[model samples]
Target: MTIHLSKSRLKYLSRLGLFLFLLILSGLFYASCNTQSSRNQSGKAHLGESPMTDSMVVDQLIQRSRSFYEETGMRAEPFDRFLQEAMEIASRHNLLWQQVRILNTIGRRYRDRSAYGEALRYHNRALTIAQNINNKGLLSEVYNQIGVVFRRTDDNAIALDMHFKALRLAEETRDSFNISVAINSIGNVNANLGRYHSAIEYFLRALEYADRLDNTLGKAINNHNIGECRLKMGYPEEALEYFQKSLAYNNQIGSRAGQSICYNSIGAVYIAKDDPVTALEYLERALNINDRLGDLMQVSISHSKIGEVYLLLGDFAKADDHLNKSYELAKNIGSRFQAEESLRLLSRLHEANHNYATSLEYFKTATAYRDSILNEKNINHLTTMEAMLETEAQRNRIYQLNQMTSEQLITLGRQRLMLTIIIIIFVILAVITTLLIYQHRLRIKYNNLKNQHKLLRSQMNPHFIFNALSAIQVYVLEHDVEKSTKFLTDFAKLMRLVLKTSHHDFIPLKDESEILKYYLELQKLRFVSPFNYQITIDEGLDQENTFVPPMLTQPFVENAVEHGVRLMENQGHLDIRFKKLNTQMVVEVEDNGIGISSSIDQKQKSGINKKHESMAIKITKERLDVIRNDIGGKVSLEIIDKKNINPFDRGTLIRIILPIVSQNN
Candidate 1:
């Protein structure tokens, strides 16, 4: 049946019986690949949801994005800036997974926007990162995302194969959410192959899992699939049943897009039964949703359906009007199914009116699209298979591991030398276990550091940009042209520094310290004389060689100025000191302003986080989760005199410590 189990489904293996059998036979956990890294959000915005609804914004965003790229054949600078910003945020805080996740999101967005080539690039970048970290989850997600692109490109076979691999990973990972998705994807491929029964079975299986997972969106999608198959089988009544149910589900979830799809499919069924009036009503409703959502794919499909209805109604001119519109959209988006459907309907409409030449032209176009679709499916199938076979080969490697474990044990009776060797091996195993524990700890440490770096990077820029722009605006408003010009120039230079550092693996301590000063200077312009500051860098400190996190210390300084100094009655004195003590390099920024209040918890802290003071702090903590691996040096944020700090704090003190490095090339 080629019913590949996704990692999420693999989690059910024990309960499902398949996993238990494999586990008992293998004597170790065989990876059910929950490799699909991203999860399908249940139908929050159904195909039936209104395009104008807030929920449809995401779909709308993708649709507009695709049009922009397709027509220009280029991505806008703002889009790239957003991506770059995401990267910067990830890098400064050292959040590798978050970075990869954001990259995946961008790729998915691009793919939906019909920027396949860009989508592929971002997906590959994410894949490469996931591979380096051996993050099976992330790798699975990238594969599934890549597979989705292929599916959209009309390489159904290849898409199916990639989806199978993704399913295996999802199963291995026990990710039920994506398992249902992978299952439905396979059903789609089978449907394309004309295996309607098999497709129904797959969809039904997906529905079972969806029900268990409480995934309403998945259920609706399955319903839609069932409706399509039934319609194809000439069961308009049955198709209507599924379509209506799907619409209800979509309505429950507020999925306008889902609603649109249901309407379109239902209209198609009615049209097949030669009920043009009902068809037009439903198709018109579908078109309204499509126009709002701006879903080009659905737009193409809806137009074709509308044209078919018009043709059947014997409205030659109206049918031709809709057909030409559908044809352009279908060709532009590369939807063979829509293109062919539109062309065929156009041919019939023309022939009915005795336009033989026009009808022949459309017939030829439909034939060409049909052939193109067929060729695409064939190539896609082969590609999908190649990936599946390679993954299967990886499974074979697991067998080799099993064989090795078996060979390591003596099958024959025990001997004196053998007994001694066994003891030694056991001891070695214990030592290795300890080493792995230590290594895991180290990994956690590095991961935390990586996360910390990313947070700092994310926090710094927006803060700087905001303050800089404010200063520039204030000067320009006062007609201080030269000052306004200077502020912008400085902002530009700082921005350049930020851009340069964004791509780097690390930055010099000197440059890192300098960034904080520029950041502080920008802030000073905003508050006027709200705060005062001092800077101390230890003598003989290797300015060029000493490494410090970019923007790591800036937040603390800014926090002190905004929350600590601004609240105080007296002149707020902010002190910054950097010193290398033995192997440890410490940077302390202390402020004498209003103290932190004991009443307010960390979560309520304002002016610090991007969202809240605590948000920035929490983000930093989450990002530093990787650092839990290392027990050595540390980075921390603590209010020195907790009682002295206030929500209207006198001021705050932040101390950061890290290992000092001597080498810089």
Candidate 2:
């Protein structure tokens, strides 16, 4: 080793050593490359028989699972199995995108089953993968899915935050579909929080995006959401229109679940309109669809709505049956909200049937369910806060790792502070607007009450009293003691009846009939001409049960007796009839005397003042308008001149139609 060598031999040996080291290095590099290639190929092989086949297989699996979930609803076992297999395939292949999809599917399945904890776990995993891959599209979908889970769990604040994140990412990525989905989800959260106008605005934006994308499902869902918001806001007519549009879209898309929802919503609108028969028909159709689809949740809702319809129709047995079925189905499905609704309806049904004890039990159960809902909301709030704290911790850790400058950090803090200030301002404005609306409604109510009182006073006409007193004075001057006594007694009774009835807004039909009888008798005695009168009442009317505004028919009767009968040369006849027509009471006052036109013409020729009669008619019309507003029904008057039809038949027929209301109503 220490032998001396020539300079050329030493240089050749050094070069040979360098060549051997280079060869060793090259050999090691090739070995590492081969090992990595083998590992990647093996991972790909584990996913399927071949790389090409793996993609097809995974796609087919995803499509099949999605179809099954859509057709049925949250069949957890099958869905979980499919999702697990897809996840394993994705993991083995190291497919980050595929893993995100699989994890999101798992999260959705868990959410559908109401397992919020498990749902959050998988959604968080998907979010991690999306962040690692730095895929904005994938991140948007993950955020949206998480938002939907949070919304379902009643964590509205977190849900709204996630939806806003998703919307931002979707817009950045130019993902139209995900943007629409995010907007719709936000709308749903707003609706759940009872911010109907905000919900509607979001839904409309979603609808616009959905229409641009030609997404039939998105369009239908957005329409349905708008309908729900409108319904909640007490716009049943507008809600019904939206629901019909949704139904048409659902039908076009062949979406049975959407169709069922639309039908249920339409039925609810009809129920609000008090058209129970039509509501029943729509609800039954929805029930049939839900039954066929095996959608227990929708079935439960349909049963509850049908029960409401039956209750309205006074079919107690049917109402009891449907409500019990609704309760059982809702219980089976673990839908506490639907269960609470069913219980409330059952309580109302039992109360309607006069079972106070049973109704109280149901009411207590409903209250307990309501309390449980509130507790669940509180729990959701705690969970959302925990999630937010965790997210903040992660952000802090991320910020520490980031190479952002101090100026950038300060700017971000300023931006956050500004955002907070803006939100506070918005909330304050919303509160102010709500207060203003409430104050306006109070003012309108006060004005209505004041007008009602004024109308009541105006209804007590002075001309009739003066004329009656003048007629009584004539009898007193004639010294007819017996006739004067009989006339005075009838007149006193009539005056007392008018005074009593004028004090109240509504009187029983029987009481009004008695008042009218006394009034006509007084008029007959006061008049010198021979006058005959008949009163007919429909057998179908329950006079004691039906109520009408006091003094409704008196003005018309006074006009017939004073103007028509008084001017007649021959024997005057008056016919008064009360008949019940569906929900309305029809009062007909027919006088075989001078028509209204002839009476007016005669008054004009005699230079007589008929201003009081015209004023009374106007007041009666105004009173009817007020009564119609109070009772939520129509009150109309029609005048028919018999002389117009036949010259020989000189008379006026007045018909007053009024809504029949119950005392409790």
Model 2 residue 240 distance off true place after TM-score fit, in angstroms: 1.5
Per-residue lDDT of 14-85 in model 2, one digit per residue for the tens? 565556556655665686589779988775554333465666667778888788777767544634566777
Worst 10 residues of 1 by lDDT: 31-40
The residue pairs that clash in candidate 2, if any, are none
Candidate 1's TM-score reads 0.44
For residue 454, model 2's alpha carbon misses the true position, in angstroms, by 99
- Candidate 2 residue 151 Cα shift, in angstroms, is 2.2
lDDT of 1 by residue, 134-228 (tens): 66676777778877877776677768887898798888998887788888988888888788999999999999999999889998999999889
Evaluate model 2: give its TM-score. 0.52
Misplaced by over 4 Å in model 1 are 1-79, 113-121, 152-158, 328-340, 364-665
Deviation of model 2 at 6, angstroms: 28
